[model samples]
Target chain A: TQLLEQSPQFLSIQEGENLTVYCNSSSVFSSLQWYRQEPGEGPVLLVTVVTGGEVKKLKRLTFQFGDARKDSSLHITAAQTGDTGLYLCAGALLENAGNMLTFGGGTRLMVKP
Target chain B: DVKVTQSSRYLVKRTGEKVFLECVQDMDHENMFWYRQDPGLGLRLIYFSYDVKMKEKGDIPEGYSVSREKKERFSLILESASTNQTSMYLCASSFGGLHSPLHFGNGTRLTVT
Candidate 1:
């Protein structure tokens, strides 16, 4: 089975602090996606990285897909309280697998003002 | 903007009861998915449909079944509700392809007593 393992299951930091969360797996994927979920809501897609070694930025958030397509990372620069949420990484398998996704255990981030 | 709407925000049911959770998407996407979220496990896919009347088992489909009789609607069914099945159920939709991002609904929190 394809599995994505996320690090630092919980994080609490003051506003303006920086943090990085990682998603790793032994199996290679065709693409990687990051999502953020708030309390009482389903996850919303934040970014998707399709090419190996690709990096995508959305305001203060930076997402990176590893060269081998087996890992990914999300980094926040100067995190604000608004950035607090559960961050999830999902790996999408090849087309033959119907492009199905395998999600990692989430990283819950709390940014205090 | 894509909107995925779930029928219920919260539900309470007794053990051994049959339950149905409904979801609809306004984007007319060709793919829909059902997932369950727990405290530690981020999100586990239960079922998915790529077309009307077509269903596929996902990673954790043991306690659940799904129906997709219409293009814009997907339903998740619990034949026999159990305490272990209590979770936050999420509904998502996406255009059929390799790189499409999923649009999600506000989840339904189901409690089995």
Candidate 2:
């Protein structure tokens, strides 16, 4: 099975600090997505990168997909207290049906004020 | 606005009790998924349906079963709840496409004793 592994299972940083999380996989994927989940809520999609070397920006958050489609990264700049949550990366396998996604272990971040 | 609604936010049930987790999507999405989130295991897909009456098993479907009698509603059933089944259950829906982003509902936290 294709697995996505996320590094630094936990992170705590002061507000306004910058942080980056990594998601790596040995298998190449057709698409990759990043999600942020708040406490007591389900994860919400932050960005989706479909092409290799693709980069998308959402305000202070930046996401990049590896050129080989085997990895991705999420970087947050000037983090705020509201950014405390769990970050997850998911990949859509090239051989699977359109609806299946394999998710990473996740990175829990705490942005302290 | 896309909304995915989970029937309950929290639940506690004794062992051997039957449990049902309900999910509904108003966006008329063709893909519905059930996942369980644990501390070290971010999101493990239990089951997914691409259409009404169509179901597919995910990575961890041993103790779970799903039903999708209607297009917008999906149900996860635990025939006999066990302590090992305790986890945060999440429901997500997305349009039927290769790179469609998922829309999630506030998860249901279930505790089995």
Candidate 3:
């Protein structure tokens, strides 16, 4: 079974602070994805990084896939209350997992103003 | 806009009761998934379907089962609801194959009392 380990299960920071959440694994993946979920809602996809060392940015969030495809990071700049949510990382592997996503434990962020 | 709708936003069931959660996607997606979200456990996949009546077990499928009688709809059934089974249920749909991001429903919060 593929396991994606995410660090800092919980985080609390003031608005405007910058933070990074990480997803690491011993196995390489074909692609890695990041999602943010708010209360009472399912997760919304933020970014999909397929290539190693690739970086994608959305206004205040920057996502980077490690050079080895075994890790990823999400950096939030000038975070706001709207950025507070549960962030999850998933991986698509080559082991014929049928494109099923293996999810991480997730990092729950609380941005207080 | 791709919209996935779950039948109920919140539900309460008694232990040992048969529970069903429904999800429908307006888009003609080929892949559908069911996941459970807890406070610290994050999201755990329960089942997925690539086509009608073709269901695959996900990471955590022990006490839950799923049915996909149609492409647009997927249903999750709790044969015998347990207290520990109380959690937020999420449903998601993806138009394309692997590497494509998923569009998720609002989610169903099931509390078994």
Candidate 4:
């Protein structure tokens, strides 16, 4: 089974602080995706990285895919209360003749003002 | 904007009772997915459908089944609900592609007592 492990299961930081979440796996994936979910809502896609060593930025959030395609990271430059949520990483695997996403446990971030 | 709608936001059921979760997408997406989220397990795929009347088991599919009779609607069924099955169920849909972004519903929090 393909498993993606996320570090720092829970994080609490003051607003404007910087934080980074990591997702690691031994198995290589074709692509990696980042998602954010609120307490009572489902996850929403933040970004998708397909190429090895790819980097994408969305405002204050920066995402990077490892060169080996087995890991990824999300870095927040200056965290805000609005960034408080569960951040998830998913790796794309080929299964049953289709692309399937295997998600990590996730990092719960709480940014206090 | 893409919108994925889940029929219920919360559900309560007794053990051994049959349960069904419904999902619909207005974008005519060909791919629909069902996932369960737990405190430390992020999201685990239960089932997915790539087209009408076609279903595929995901990594964690035991005790769960799915139906996709129409292009926009998918249903997840639990023949005998158990306490362990209680979770936040999320429904997602996306256009067919290698790296298409998934649009998700608010999610259904099911509690089987």
Write one digit per residue (lDDT tens) for candidate 1, span A26-81. 88889999999999888898999999999999999999999999999999999999
| Candidate 3 wrong stretches, greater than 4 Å | none
Q: Which runs in model 1 stand beyond 4 Å of their true positions?
A: none
Tens-digit lDDT track of model 2 for A1-113: 32999988999999999999999999999999999999988899999999999999999999999999999999999999999999999999978767688999999999999
Instruction: Report every candidate's CA lDDT.
Output: 0.92, 0.94, 0.91, 0.92
**Model 4 misplaced stretches (Cα beyond 4 Å):** A94-97
> Candidate 3 falls in which docking quality class?
medium
* Top-down lDDT ranking: 2, 1, 4, 3
lDDT string for model 2 (B1-113, tens) is 89999999999999999999999999999999999999968899999999999999988999889999999999999999999999999999999877899999999999999
> Could you tell me the TM-score of candidate 4?
0.96
lDDT of 1 by residue, B1-113 (tens): 99999999999999999999999999889999999998778789999999999999988999899999999999999999999999999999999788778889999999999
Strongest candidate by DockQ: 2
Report the poorest 10 consecutive residues by lDDT, candidate 1 chain A.
A93-102
Q: DockQ of candidate 2? A: 0.88
In model 3, which residue pairs have backbone atoms overlapping below 3 Å? none
Model 4, B5-100: lDDT tens digits are 999999999999999999999998989999999888888999999999999888789999998988999999999999999999999998978878
| Higher-ranked by lDDT: 1 or 3 | 1
State the weakest 10-residue window (summed lDDT) of model 4 chain B: B94-103
Please provide TM-scores, in order, for all candidate models, with all chains considered together.
Answer: 0.97, 0.97, 0.95, 0.96
In model 4, state the lDDT of residue A62: 95
Quality class of the docking in candidate 1, CAPRI style: high
TM-score (0 to 1) for chain A, all models?
0.95, 0.96, 0.96, 0.95
